[model samples]
Target: MSSIPSPTLSAPSPRVNEGMSQGTPACPSSCDHFDLDYTRQEDVRTVVETMMTAHQTYHNRMHAYFKKFPSKEAALLKPHPDTTKEQWKELCDLFTSEAFMKQSEQNKKNRSKLTVNHAAGSRSFQCTRACMKNQESSNINPVELYKKNYTNKDGIWTSEGAREIYRQCDLEGKTYTEIEVYSEILGKKSGYVRGLGRAVKPPPSSTLTTQSSDLQHQLAKARDEIEAMRVAREKDLQEFAKKQAEMEATLRDHREEQWVEQERIRLEQEERMKMEQEHMRVEHDERMQKEQEHMRKEQERLPVEISKKLEKKMSSVMEKKMNDMSKRLFSQFGGSKK
Candidate 1:
């Protein structure tokens, strides 16, 4: 099986912290419940983006880990080491379910049809705005912020559509906010805010009625939806925290295992080297003994070889002397007879 590519997860941006500080409910020691002011657009945007990013990050991580196993049944049978059996089973069911698979395939198709993609990565438009304000110490023009987030660093537009939208916004003048420009040019989308990502849902549509009762009913419905979103956001945050802790623990365990494996290899190499050295030493000793034995045999045979040569020389010298003495005696006897 092909290895699963792990998704890169980042810490919550500064905008998330800013949003939490401004809009998150603060519960006292004795109080269990607190209220969120959904009317504030900035706070609402912050919460929405945080929740959406966290949810997407979590879904991607789960899918990446699930891909490690050959099948959903196998994955459920052997849950991730970092997750509980119950959690793993639930994830397996969700990933393998027909409804989810259909949605996932549809999402892929939708992504493939896109002509333009922002270069901002995980940074939301709100975070981009915050950064602009901090760096320039001035309020960023909404159109300029949109351009910055959509275009590349060299100021090239990602797509002709994005560029045309910018041109339209420019011709319309500077009064329009980023969201207003998108809504005006692209037409208002029913479910989500036009410029913001899919996180922030728009207010429900209301009938053009003069009656006070109808207005009250619309307001009540809006409040219900807002409350529901707040509750869902809280739950998402809790799940994200739990998963983050598990990932960290898993990383630590992996590092420890890697270190242990490296140490084992080092020790094995040392043992092999010691054995090689011992073998070389034994060979050296055997070679020295062979040389020494050869020299001792040569030394013992040297005296016998020298004694044989001396005996042969002395016998030849004695025979020559006896021949010379006989010749002299014969010559003298012959002279006396004459």
Candidate 2:
């Protein structure tokens, strides 16, 4: 049986290496190199799982925000307030893609089937292993690491499956390496290492010298990408600041215009009220003058009417007295003649 080749100096220790024949089941290159620490935690599983959770949450939030728009076209036209136009357009395309939708649905189905959840809050397995190595001065066995991550402080297994796997993988005086035991139980997975987080890429299946060269190249590429991203971020921040200032200035100008318009309307209303009051005062004065003129004419007509009535009554009384005096004189003369 052909033995597996030793990894580079940067790779994990030989204890984690799979010593199976070429035909036999073997773990990925990432499983062998436990040296690379992707997270602060020694527990690789917890860190990987936490990262997965955060990635899913970010996508979910983005999808939810995307749904707020009427359509993908509309979303693309109006990018998110926090993100740049290019970033928003890319996200819009991703969210609307059929492949992404299918993957999201499949992920939902897989999540629904899960029965037991890990008790570790945000803590990871890498951190746990680091702590153990610090205390024991030796690399922690894979089985022990699994138990520590799954089980509570009381040493009870988290689930029946976990307990069964632990019992089966327990060396128990047998001659099986911890890596072999884990590979047999967990089975082989493509791409990322089984326990390690996705952030850690699997080493290439090549010579040690070639692997070292490739790693150096990858590191250089990553640095370049990081620098580019930093520059882009700075530019985006400057643009965002400029846009914010412009928006504030526009809003301030709009408010000032509105204030001026309102003041003009208020002044016009005040002037109209004053004009109406003056007109009312003028009309009231004219009415008072007309009333005074009518009262004076009534006074003059009343004296004239009273004087005419008295003269007519006196003339009628004098005529009746003259008739009586004439009749009395005629009667006295007739009696003397007789």
Candidate 3:
């Protein structure tokens, strides 16, 4: 017999093979590469870049201030010179402050992005107005931005996010900065341009004075809220304890009432049974006494009846004997006469 030809499996097309080799399908243009609200940790490079920008802006403002007020005896001259140790410490505090940072964010939101070309004559006046506004804005207090931003689970500061990503990717033995660099290389979107550092520059003496007052006010408010919460918590605990005690007392009283009612019913039943038994005993005793009396009367009547029968029999016997004697005497007398 002849065998039929076997069918062969076909290979995949060249385009399919090319896609498989490339490891991933190409993205369509409609698909966005950058996610504005990405959940990943912000990159260190972005933080560094933002810091550099803030520093440059601060430098420019300082140059403009000196140029406008060339004399050393100017009113805007601060107690501590810029970039000094004391000034740097204050700068750090200013940047870390929550209220000031929040105000900066709000200002960013409110301000127009478009740059306007103003005349040279109006530049100095506008600059002065802006400086005064910054001073007024310093009236807002600072929050713990550093603690909030760096300490949480989603934080990348101090290389936490980098370390986590590295662990997930099976990488080991890298410093924090190196891990961040590797994370970027892995095609992860770690880069960000949000408000990374303290957005506001350190203010002069006039602004610092207002900022200090605002800080004190915020601290006081926080303390008051904490105290109020403590008092409310204590009150709630006391109320709970009071309610528990009342419930226990009510239960106890109800149990006692139930026991008392059961005891009363038991006593009543016992007394009723005792009275019935006593009544039955009295009735039985009376019946026995009546029967005994009837028996005694019957015994006395029986003896009297026996004595009467005996006397009648004796009298009959005497009468019959006397009649027989008389008859014999008569017969003898008659024979003598003959």
Error of 3 at 125 (Å): 45
lDDT of 1 at 149: 76
Candidate 1 per-residue lDDT, tens place, 1-338, comes to 12222211123345544545575432111011112345545446646765776888887888888989899878878877778988888889999999989999999999889876777775656466555654544445667777887898899988898898778878977555445444454445544554443433443333433454576677778778888998899999999999999999999999999999999999999999999999999999999999899888888888788777777777777777778877788788877899
Steric clashes per prediction: 0, 11, 7
Worst 10 residues of 1 by lDDT: 26-35
Model 1, residue 99: distance off in Å is 2.0
TM-score-superior candidate, 1 or 3: 1
Comparison by lDDT, 1 against 3, better one:
1
RMSD of 3: 26.8
lDDT by residue for model 2 (225-282), tens: 9889999999999999999999999999999999999999999999999999999999
State which candidate, 1 or 2, has the greater lDDT.
1
- Candidate 1 deviation (Cα RMSD): 30.4
Q: Score each candidate by Cα lDDT.
A: 0.67, 0.66, 0.47
Candidate 1 — what's its lDDT?
0.67
lDDT of 2: 0.66
Error of 2 at 232 (Å): 2.3
Candidate 3: which stretches are off by over 4 Å? 1-241, 306-338
Q: Which ten residues in a row have the lowest lDDT in candidate 3?
A: 193-202
**Alpha carbon lDDT at 10, candidate 2:** 38
